[model samples]
Target: MSTDLPTRRAPNWLGAASAGLAVAAIVGEGFAIGIASDGGWGQATVLAWLVIVLTAAAFFGGLVATVVGLGRGAGMAAMVLGLVGNPLVLIWLLGALGTS
Candidate 1:
């Protein structure tokens, strides 16, 4: 008799939800910063969109890795990347892009 345990996998819903939350956090922060920085609604919208793209890219990368059984590292990397990069990029976009 042979006994073996199957490898654990990342839950699709959990992964998807985590990514979604990350994106939302980034966008929400951008919105608040934009409004406070005199960006108005339009500028805030643009900032939010930028964050969305960044998060989407991270999500896609993580998803691919997860499918290949490398989700642990990839998901962690994605979360870290989003948490670190989002604020930095948000500040830059708000200040540099301006609301003109």
Candidate 2:
């Protein structure tokens, strides 16, 4: 008789990676904000695009982590910490761009 059963949660490393990606997304947003504020390369469309990409990745990644790795808590943290902060960052980014 087999005592070990398959686990429902993803591997520890994957959860950790998800968490890291979430954090990195926020860092990227900070860089984007800095640039948007004329603190760095102003009017850098490429960097703006990069930030948008990272934000999308974070949101999707966080969704996966939340669904498959929620047992580890990293997924939930990513959802709560990363997802919550992202919208405001995006709004601020847009405002800085004078889009809204």
Best model per lDDT: 2
Question: Which prediction has the highest TM-score against the true structure?
Answer: 2
Which pairs of residues clash in candidate 1, taking residues 3 or more apart in a chain or in different chains?
A: none
The TM-score values for the models, in the order shown, are 0.38, 0.58
lDDT of 1: 0.62
lDDT of 2 at 93: 70
Supply every candidate's count of residue pairs whose N, Cα or C atoms clash at under 3 angstroms. 0, 0
Q: Per-residue lDDT for 1-100 in model 2, tens only? A: 9999888744665446666776776776667777768856655456666655655565666677667664357766665556545655657777889964
Judge candidate 2 at residue 1 and give its lDDT.
90
Residue-level lDDT for 63 in candidate 1: 60
RMSD of each: 8.6, 5.2
lDDT of 1 by residue, 1-100 (tens): 7588878755555345545556566667657576858848777766666676667666665566555545456465566556555756657778887867
Off by over 4 Å in 2: 1-10, 39-44, 87-89, 92-100
